[model samples]
Target: MTAWAVLAGVAARLCALGLTASAAWLIARAAERPDLSALGLAIVAVRAFASARGVFGYLERLAGHDAALGRAAGQRVRLYRALAHGPLPAGSRGAGSGGGEALTHMVADLDAGQDLRLRCALPAIVAGVAGTAAVAFCWALHPASGAVVAAGALAAGLAVPAAAAAAARRLGARLAGARAELAARVMDLTDGRADLVAFGALDFATAAAERQARRLARTERLSGGVSAAALAAGTAVQGLTALGVAWAAAGTGAVTCAVLVLTALVALDAVQPAIPAAQLWVELRPAAARVRRVVRADAALPPDERPHRPAVPGRVALRGVRVRYGDVPALDGVDLDLSPGRSVAVLGESGAGKSTLLAVLAGLVQPGEGLALLRPARGLYQDAHLFAATVRANLLMAKPDAGDAELRAVLDRVRLTGWLDALPEGLSTPVGAGGRGLAGGQRQRLLLARALLADPEVLLLDEPTEALDAATGRAVLAGVLRARHGRTTVVVTHREDALGLFDDIVVMARGRVELHDAGDRQPIGRAFPSA
Candidate 1:
């Protein structure tokens, strides 16, 4: 990365040299034109110089662009790693629904940052050097002419762009922030759209999204307008410098009218790279906070560190666990134990700490004042993600080298065999997000299949059936009941239908364990009290 940055810097300097040389040669050629033979000689020399300059210019972009991309890639990797760390206090977990947006900003927004670094900073530095050299070149021929063109070049490319960049810095940041925000909110809106529609809150959220879109468009337009204005100022400087050269050329010496034209054109070109750079910086201004947010978040955690993988497997226990979410305490001094070959059902309301409790168990959220242990095993909390990969792939995520027979058996037990085979790619076939490829039943079954495949000591299920139909739920419940014979499972649920699968029952209310039982009544309507 350091080497690339250095090479880019050198290229910027080379570009400056090329611009100055091209300008001097052009001005000289313009002055000598008139006699056909003499003009041809000058034109030929100018063409050769132009060709060489073009090559150098291309080289500058080639070397510099890669550096920018490489830097952006490094940042993306860093941010993604931090996101993986869990075990934070419950309130802070899954705080950002716009996670995709943050990732987008890190990669693309940072790419724009690279654009500014290469196109603006590198060239501006180069232009400053070239402007000075062009001034010296003209001065050597005619001192007065050199001074004016050199000064004008600085004003056009260096000074003006720099000033505009400073002014636009805040604007750039806002634009970047807005773009990130737009991306994040879009992700949030999509992820939460079902909830919104179901709750009849679509209009409110949609209006907010629309407002964000309008602001982004307006910011872009304003940025463009600023850039256009900056370009005009650069043009004015170049044109004036050229006019001065033309006047000086009339007095004909080593430099003339032709040289002045080249000087003006070269000066104008200096402004081009700065324009992109300035825009990038401007966009970055708004997103700086977002960048910091992602980069600095959970800074203590490194991306490569996996939570310690315990070799043994058996159960997960939350003992004297106290967890508070936001201003409300979700799990308060709750004591619970789930052992291998047993399952417990958690009962609660929407704000009844059901989800919060699951998060603690899964290592997604940490207990504020207690021990959450995977006793000789592991557990997955509710809100566990299913990547948009193959059904088999999702299952294999827990045990990558799981054999075909193992996968088939697990799939069969969960009753996903029919749906998994329906796909054209079969096992390799992709599943749509949140189970788009599979029916709601299939998606839930796939998640369950994954837990079974892992065969962890303890399984944590939170609203696991929210996406499944009643029939599929029964199959899943049956499978869990079967699973209970061999492993410990803790389920967070409000509905009593799934209760029969558990060997024990625990009810959490006001962050307290409202009810806990080991033996069941063994009554007929075991799953739920069929009213």
Candidate 2:
């Protein structure tokens, strides 16, 4: 596809050069009062070249955009897979993360990949081919004129573009930083709009956002000035080259001199895109780097390419596992083992590595030094995002082909049956971005419903009941355990009400297991009869 795009671009530029030279020859020859037949062929050549230029120009655009869009679709798929299944970069997990900033990186930064191909590589190749041909054609007719055209092409294509790229590199770093700060400020205002109003600080936050906007505008003005300078430089070279070619070919006939001068002018214009293309190439490098950091799983450590499944399904084992964030250890030298169909309740205080342990089991974090064997697992955390979509649409993410009955069943289990019936559109109701339209308890139950629908071999829950009252939390917890019977389940919680339902209890402190006990379990109906 790329090869076809380049071919069409070269053909279009050459036809444009042919049209200019033919028109110049016809005008000069007609001034000599010659017969009509003497100028017939030149007139025909002008018309044919004029028509071909537009045709090839259209083909060039069609082919180039087709190739670019096709590649973009494939790139989006790979990016989604990397974020969903592979190890994430540091500080990208847990509540209050900068999801808005990460979204900017995914969209704006990924676009840089497309620009590298469409804008930089395509334009550079087309300019080189067309510029060389123009110089050689003029040189064959008149050596002095050819030398003038070659010098002008080098100045416009090489020297001016090089200077533009250098200036852009210096300003591009500062521009990227400004854009990131602006995105963060805007997201905070949107997420905390209610609190800002309640505290009487809305005006202050708006002022800060306006300040960021003004700074971004100032940087953009500076970038525009650089582009204007490159444009002026290219124009100056075109005018000077026309004069030089005319002087060199003075001795030749008037008709030939006119053709040579016009050819040089049009050829210089054809390669003018080189200047901006070089600048854009320099500016897009930093954005491209951001995308690379997220897509590559081995950013911090070498990846273990071997499959990590245990000998039996729904079983997990970890020995001497350690994970460190910078100088601080999140999980240090932990050993654990769980058999299939066992339910374990993990109790810990804040900063006890409870969340990090869940991450390790879900395969989002790889142990820096140790052996970890696990099965496929699913986790339900408090911060799980709910996209701006319909209720049915959100549920379909877990099971794409799920029917209405299946969705209703899961919602009933999570105690959302009444809420669903109260909606104006029932299953088709639209939830605002991040579930802003729902109450805290409603959002928690919706996420729990999604987790129940997934039903993976191993279930991991991190403070799943933190948003509800004690009684409702107990009832919801019981329903989940009852549904997940005959599977491996791990609950990381501080509540004591659900302890009687688990077969084992584990206490953790300072990244180490402080206690472990194999206790007897009561029947689910006896413990939580109301469930």
Q: Rate the local accuracy (lDDT) of all candidates.
A: 0.64, 0.79
Report how far off residue 390 is in candidate 2 (Å).
8.2
lDDT of 2 by residue, 131-229 (tens): 999999899989999999999999998899999999998778778889989998898799988999999998999999999999999998998999899
Pairs clashing in candidate 2? none
Specify the poorest-scoring 10-residue window by lDDT in model 2. Answer: 522-531
- Per residue, candidate 1 scores C-alpha lDDT tens digits across 34-126 of 556655654565566556556666766766677667766776676555454332223332342333433454556555556656655666566
Cand. 1 Cα-lDDT: 0.64
Please give the distance, in angstroms, between residue 55's alpha carbon in candidate 1 and its true position after superposition. 6.5
- List candidate 2 stretches off by more than 4 Å: 29-48, 76-116, 141-147, 166-176, 183-194, 247-256, 282-383, 386-443, 457-460, 467-478, 485-491, 494-531
Evaluate model 1: give its TM-score. Answer: 0.55
TM-scores of the candidates in the order shown: 0.55, 0.71
How displaced is residue 276 in candidate 1, in Å?
Answer: 1.4
